[model samples]
Target: MSKQDGSNRLVSGPEVDDSTATILHVDLDAFFASASLLARPDLIGRPVVIGHDSSRSVVTAATYEARKYGVHSAMPMSRALRLCPNAVILEPDFSLYSRLSKQVMAILDDTSPEVERLGIDEAFVGIGGLRRLSGGANRIGAELRARIRRETGLVASVGAASTKYVAKLASSRAKPDGLLVVPADAVIDFLHPQPVSALWGVGPKQQERLARYGLHTIADVAHTSQERLSAWFGEATGRHLAALAWGRDPRTVEEREHEKSFGHSHTFSRDITDRSEQEGELLRLATGVGRRLRDAGVQARTVTLTVRFHDFRTITRSRTLPEATDVTRVIVEAAWSMLEQLGEMPPVRLLGVRASAVQDASDHGLLWDDTETWGSAERAMDAVHDRFGAATVVPASMLRRERKRDDTGPSGGD
Candidate 1:
C-alpha cells in the first residue's frame, strides 16, 4: 500500500456517494488480518486465517482471500479450515492488535475529537465543524488513508456522509482502502435502490417480515405506509425504519459517555422446537438483562427480543415502555409478550435479550414504595450472588441452561 495507489485520488466511480457529507466512517482494512500480514508479507494476498487451530476456536479474522472461500470473522476455525484447507492459520497476537489499534486510534484522534468508535476497526468521525480548517470531508478522508499508510503501514477505507448511518454505508461501499462521498441532496438517490436489508436495523428475520409485505427495496419501504409499518414493527421502530429508508437519519457523532446498550444471546447446542422451551429461554435471558440493568444502576426504556431459527433466519422485536424500570418481572413479561407477537415458534437456534435507552436510576417524585421495595430485595439478591456465585440467586422458574451458566459468572452487567 502506498500514497500513489489512486485510492487517495478523487475519481468518478459508480460506488461514490457525492452527498454533502461531513461525517467520516473510517475503517482499517482487515485490521487483525492485515497486521498479521505485515510480518508475513508472503501471505499478503493469500487465504490467511487469524485464530487458533482448535475444535472450539473461532476465526477472529480472515483475509479477503479467505473470505472469497466464505470464511469470515466469528466463524468456527474447524469450518474455516474445511472451507479453505490450504489457508495459513495464524494465531492472533492481541498485544500486536492492541498496539496497532492504539496507533490507528491515535491517528483518528489527530483528525478529530468527535470520533465515535464502533469497534477497533471502524468509527464515525464528524468533520462538519472542521470543514474550513481541513479542506472538506472527502479530502480529509483521502488524506487520512494516505497518512495511515505512511505512518502505520496500514490502509483505511472511509465513507463520508451527512449522517453517521449513511456514512457507514458509504464506507462499506468503498472497501479495501477507498473513499466514497455521499452528498446530502444525493442521499435519496443513493439509498432507494438498495435492498431493505441494507438498512441498519433490518436483519434476516426483519427482512423476511418486510418481504412478506413486498417491501424488498428501500424504495418499497419509503413508499409503504408508516401506519402499516408501525402495525408490524411497533410505532417507534416502524417510523425509524421509514425515516432511514428516506435517508433521514438525525443522529449526531459525539464522544460516548457510557455504553448505550447491553445484551446477551446464547446459541443452543441442539435446536429446540417447542414453544414452551423457547419461552423458558427468553424468560431466562430477560432475567439476565434485568439483573445487568440493575447492577449498572440504570433503568432501560426499551427491551428487545431476538429469536434465531434453525435455518439461521433471525427475528427481533423492540418495545419502548412508557416508563423505564429494571425489574425482572417486567422485563420477563415484556419479553414474553414479544415472543407471543411471533405467532408460533419455529425450531430455534438462539434466543437473546437486550436493553437500551438507558438512563441513571433516579427517584422521580411521587414514586411508589413497591418499586423501592423491589429494588432493595433485588440488591440483596445481587449481594448473595456476588458472595456465593451467580448460581446462588436466580428466578424460581429458571431453565437448566441459565442455572448451569451461573457458576462463577459476573453478578451482573453485560
Candidate 2:
C-alpha cells in the first residue's frame, strides 16, 4: 500500500503527498439549504433549517448556525424548533437541489474522468490522471474547490488522501467549507485520534458498546487485538473494524451507472392508523422498487422496509433472500414479512422500501418456479407499463381503490 516504488515515488507536500493523494471526497456545504437560499441572498449567514414542519417531517439539512443549537439532519422538526426557535425554516425543493447537484457533478466530471458519485451532494474523484496538467493532486483538489465556487456560486469542501475511507473522513473533518489532505504514510495518524463514531460502520449503539469496553477512539480499536474485536462485534464486523482502524481500505473508486441501493419513500399527509392502508402502501413501495430493479437489469438480494411512527420514532428491518430476484412477488413478500416483525404499530407517518446487494440480471439465475410464473408475469407487466404508462398496471388490490378515486374526481363540467 506504500505509494513509493522505483518510478512511482510519492512527492511529499504539506500534510499530504502529491503523488499518493489521488482519491478525493467532495461534499457540498449544507446542500439542501444552501441550494435553496441561492435565490434568497438575504438569508445567508443565518440559522436555516430545511424540510417541512408537517406531521412527520425530519430535518434534511441545517446551516452551521442551526447546527450549533443541536439541530442536525434526520432530527425531528419539532425537536429542532425546540432547540433553535429563531432558525429560519425552508421547505425542501428537491428539483432545485437536483439541478445544483448535476452542475457540481459536471464540474467534477470535467476535473476527473474517474468520478464516483456517492450521493446527490457528494462524490469521490480519482485525480491520478490530472498530475501533469494540474501540477499535482493537491493543486487539482484546490482547483476543484476554486472552480466549483467560481462556476456554481456554492462552496464545496474537499478531502484528498490515499484511500476512499480516509478521504471521506478527511472531507467531513473539513466541514461547511474547507479542505484537508492526508498523506499515504500519515493515514494511520489521521484516523487514530478521531472518535470511535468516526469509523465507517460504527453507529450510535455500537459507539455505546465500544465506550463500555473503554474503546473511545480509533487508536483504541487499533491497539485492541482482532480476537477481542471479534468477541465484541462478532466475526465479520470485527475483522472489518480491525482493518479500518489501521487505515486499511482496499476499495477503489468506480463509476456506478446505478446505485447499489435504490428505493422510494413517502410521507403521508395524515398519519395512517389502518393496518390495511399501511400494508397497501408497503406493497406499493415494494412493487415500485422491484420494477426499478428489473428495469435497471439488476437483481437485489436484500429488501429493507422503513416505517416511521407519528412520534418520529423509526424502525427498519431487512431480509436477505436465498437467491437474488427482481420479481415483485418476492420483493413485496419479503418487505411485508419484515414489516410484520415491527410488532403492533402505532399510527404510521411514513413508509419506505429499498433494494440492495444488487447484481446484474444476466448474472442472476432464476429457480424453476420463479422463471415459470412470477418472473414471466413481472416481465409482462414491465412491458405493459413501458408501452402504455406507469399507472396502466398495478397490483390487483389497488385497482378497486384507483377506480373509487376516479369516481370521486370532479365531473368534466364542474
Residue-level lDDT of model 2, residues 1-414, one tens digit each, is 000111211222354555788899998877777776887889998988777765356677777767778787777778889998998888665435544666888898888789998777788998877788776667877788899889888877788888999888877776657778887888887789888988997888999999999999999999999999999889998999999999899999998654587676767767778877778877877776777677566888898888889999998888899888888888888887887777688898778888899888788567747544887888899788767756778887765443111000000000
Instruction: Tell how far residue 353 is off in model 2, in angstroms.
Output: 6.7
Query: In order, what lDDT does every prediction score?
Result: 0.73, 0.75
TM-score for each of the candidates: 0.60, 0.67
Tell me the tens digit of each residue's lDDT in model 1 across 1-414.
111122323322544543367799887877778887887998887889877666545666777777778787767778989988999988554435545666777788889888886755677888877878886776788889999899888788888888888888777667666788878888898789888977988877999998998899999999988999999889998999989998888899977523467566656656788777777877777766676677556788898988888899998999997778887767777888988888866788778888889887774431444766776787788778657766677766673543222101111100
Best by TM-score: 2
What lDDT does candidate 1 reach at residue 58? 62
Model 1 TM-score, all chains together: 0.60
What lDDT does model 2 reach? Answer: 0.75
